[model samples]
Target: MGIVLNQSLKNTIITYLGFGIGAINTLYLYPFFLGTVFYALTNYILSWANIIMPLLAFGMQNTLVKFYTQYKTEEERSRFLSFTVLIPLLLCIPLVLIGLFFFEPISLYLSKENPVVKDYLWLIPFIGLSMAYFEIFYAWARVHMHSVFGNFVKEVGLRLFSLFALIGVYYEWISVVEFIYVTAIIYFLACIITMLYAFHIKKPVFQFSIPQNVKDVLVYTFFIILSGSVAVMLLDIDKIMLNQYIKIENIAYYSVATYIASVIAVPSRAMHQITYPITAKLMHENKHDELNDLYKKTSINLQVVGGFVMLCIFVNINQLYVMVPKEYSGGILVVFLIGISKYFDLILGNNNAIIFNSKYYRMVLFLGLLLVFLTVGLNMFFIPRFAITGTAVATLLSITLYSLAKLLFVVKRMHLYPFTHQTLYSLAITFGIFLSFYFWEFPFSPIISIGLKSALVTLLYVYINYKFVISIEINQALDLVLKKLKIRL
Candidate 1:
């Protein structure tokens, strides 16, 4: 319990820092500099690239997390590291070749409305290779329990690089075409730096020995590849499919809403990355009590923080759209629907880490593919009829079903639920604040009033939690931060 709090405190600080930068990028910079259309293009491209990354990576990142603790010998560990890194590199070459071979056909299919993606398909191999390398190094760093550097690269460094690209676009130093290449270059550089840092931590040798466990791990890797690709595709394929089925500009509208809504889920993603290894370690050490405690705390903490963000977005989203062009305001329901889904995910806490690292992890993926198919069906059905709203609806329902399935799996198999009274407490508090303002008249526009309401909601939330002590994890976390800062309180 203490250790989880301590790590979470550190992670919370880091998450906030990353979120600060992310907020600027998502809200102000992307819109102000790139415009919503170009911004959507960039986001959609990356999302598709990531969806393809797991296929190219062949599950090395996941295999790294699972097998790191199992091997003992330096020789064995070094061999495993090499295997993890090389297998992805190997997988990418063939993938790139296959993509190149099918370039015209695939591009024609994907770019039914916008064939610009054909020129962009070449960028996928570069994007995939970097994505593959970054995951390998990210895994290597996680195995050493040094998430700060990897997290910085992922959460901060990559954003910082994109920040520069936005600057270039703003200056008119490059066309959007050049902007795409520069972004891919940023990913590649981040990957190189990550691997260098991992090597500095533990110089992995290039040994290729086959241990008994190696075969089993490789089998697991194959399953993980399919599962991971499916997960990424579920999250991203809508934009790609939308491009194929409709105009490219519709993707811009959908992407903006998704980007805004996704910000609500960033804290959960950051915390899960830090928590996964520790959860794996604890489970290995027969620490079920600690594991369940951490899970409950994570669930409550995520809801509290995530609910506050959701309130702010839901309240201020109208103002936000005013900042963007009026056309994107067409996506109001898209933002609301997607935002609701992300909030539901927050309540699930570290569910992804919990299930993906567990013995019953395979079951999570099996159901995940089913949800992926469902998502595709929903997208196909909705995009043609309702357009962006349909896509958002599909995302909400598919993701909700997906999350419920994983939560059920964790509870049923482990008999460990990741919730508590405090989880309900957070929800109740959010409800009270929302109801307080639901019917209240405001002197100003939604743009102005929403911000004011958000401030009040944030204050009420903090005050109530301070008084009632929502989660012991949060209290301990505050104390840890205070002690670190040499404050008596």
Candidate 2:
């Protein structure tokens, strides 16, 4: 908690702000205008960008976080940062060349539609290259203990830009196909902005210096590459698999459900951004007890926050889907499954942070690769038969298993746990609310039916939480607010 304890309120607010806008983009705009296939392709290509980006970055984002704190002086930090940036540039050439050489096979494998696949495949490396440096410079911000701007670019700026693009397509200002590629180009341009903004702040002096201890950095990079690749594989392989087995249109359906479900995971993503650098710093300082405590608190905090979100979405999923066309309703199930999978990740909290920042990370990386392999295999087995449902089931099972594996390792090896009374109560209350609405049925229009059900669900979940889940501090704060209002009889 100490590592990320500072400025958490601000970060949380920013995360919510980002999530609010992003929710509209995802839930309303995407489903309303894009249809299922395009919606899914949007998510798929973006994630695919991440899948290939790590390879291009040469795994230096992890390297930057790991090494940046070692330097005390600005000069030393600059040299290391420069070296980090330079090596990735040196690495990107090969990725471009390989991606060019392998474009058709990659496209054929990535999707069956393959309509604009050739046109879009070229954007992969460009987006990947941008991601490579975005991370490198973003790490620059993180190690400096600044999270707000990095998050602004990541969560706010890019999505806001896309919202305008989406509007452009809505008005036929740009063709949908062109807009798709344009969004990728926007990602690259945003990366440049992030890098430039980083320079504006750190203004790291890039002096020529010998790379520091090549052996250790390379060793770290090896494990991180495996870690990075496997992490991206798990996060993304579902849509990629969806493309291979199902129509690209199905990808759109899955994407909508995914967007709804994934909103619950945003807290973890934001928290992880700040927590990573702190974990790196903690491990270097050998503050085991502090690290363990922070890990537990983060898990509990995320569960409490993420549980509320998951409850909201899981309860009102029917209503939320009403905003979309009839065909995408199938994604509701996928939404539930994916939401649960992400919830498991939230419950585990900063286990990855603890592992990645620890000396024990390489072994964890090996275990992660195993999980990635299993996830791929399971998706292959299931997606052929169940389609979107199959993909959801595959993702849920694999992610839960992976989180459990990490949880057990951390408990066994470090003698730590992330659960307590609050965790139990939150889950119990959430489940009660979820099941409360599970039996409700209404004979009305989809819009009206959904709205009514969602309202009831929200009220019930809030009531349960206020009674059992919300903190004493929150209660006190509410009391203060009430007292200030001086309500009349």
Candidate 3:
């Protein structure tokens, strides 16, 4: 718990700093500097890459985390590491070949609705390849208990470079076309940096020999590919489908609203970095008691923090939208629906880690495949009628059903529940705070109104939680922060 606290706090700060820069890029720079058409193109290319990355990487990122600690000998671990790294290339090379042979037809299909996408179809595989390897190396670092550097490179480095790229576009140093190409270059560089850092953490010893559990490892990786694909598809497929059904520029509008809601998942992402490998280690050792404790603690702590973030977003969304361009202001409902879904996801805590590392992982693949089809079906039905709002509704439904299924599986199979009495209390507190402050706005500019309302919400929420002690872990964290600041609470 101590190590989890320390690393999660650091990762959270880094992630938010990255998100802060990303918010600027998403809201102000991309729309204003790049224009909506180019902005949407940028988003569309990346979302396409994300949707295909699991296949490109062959699920090695998660495979490394799940299997790395099980080996008893350094030689065996080296063999396993080498296997994870090189096996993906087997799939990647074939994919590139297929893309080369079928490029024309694929491009025509992708660009049927919007011809702008035809010229940039090549960037998807390029960026997806880079992203796939980046995760592979990042998993290498995570298993070594050194995740902060990888987290920084992942969360902040890429966004910071995008900021520079956008500025270059602003100064006319680069055309928007070149800016699009540079975005792919940024991902490639990030992958290289992470790979180098991973090496620095522990120099690799390449071995051609396979481990004894090769069959088990390959089977897990095979199923995990489906699970990983399903997860990424749920998040990014909406953006891809949007390009097909509507004008590409609307993606920018939808992107901004989704970015605001994504902040709610920050705490969960930060905590998952360290907690994932820890959960794997615990499961391997059959430490159910400690694992169960981690499950409940993570759920409550994440809900407490994530609930506060969701509250802030819901309360300040109207004011915040006032600051963005009027065209993007229509995504308010998208934010609400998506934000609630993300909060539900956060409250599940380490459920994913537990399931993916356990024997029940194959179950995820079956359920995930069903949801993937369901997601696509719902998007097809909803997007033509509702546009971006329909996409959000599809996402909300898919993720809610998916999370519910995973939660139920964990409860039935593992006999672990993330919810407790505090869960209800936390929900009550969030609803109360939202009701009290949402309509109470200051008579000022959008920025000032947001600040005033956010401060009041944070203070009242924290004070109430502190006074009542909603979560012991959160109370302890608050106490530690107050002590560090030399303030009496």
Task: Note the Cα lDDT for every prediction shown.
Answer: 0.79, 0.78, 0.94
| Shift of residue 63 alpha carbon in model 3, Å | 0.7
Better of 2 and 3 by TM-score: 3
Candidate of highest TM-score: 3
Clashing pairs in 1: none
lDDT of 1: 0.79
Residue-level lDDT of model 2, residues 32-132, one tens digit each, is: 76666667667777778889877778888888898888878777777888888888787667766876798778777665554534456666667778877
Which number leads on lDDT?
3
lDDT, candidate 3, 340-431, per-residue tens: 99999999999999999999999878999999999999999999999999999999999999999999999999998899898999999999
TM-score of 2: 0.91
Model 3 pairs whose backbones collide? none
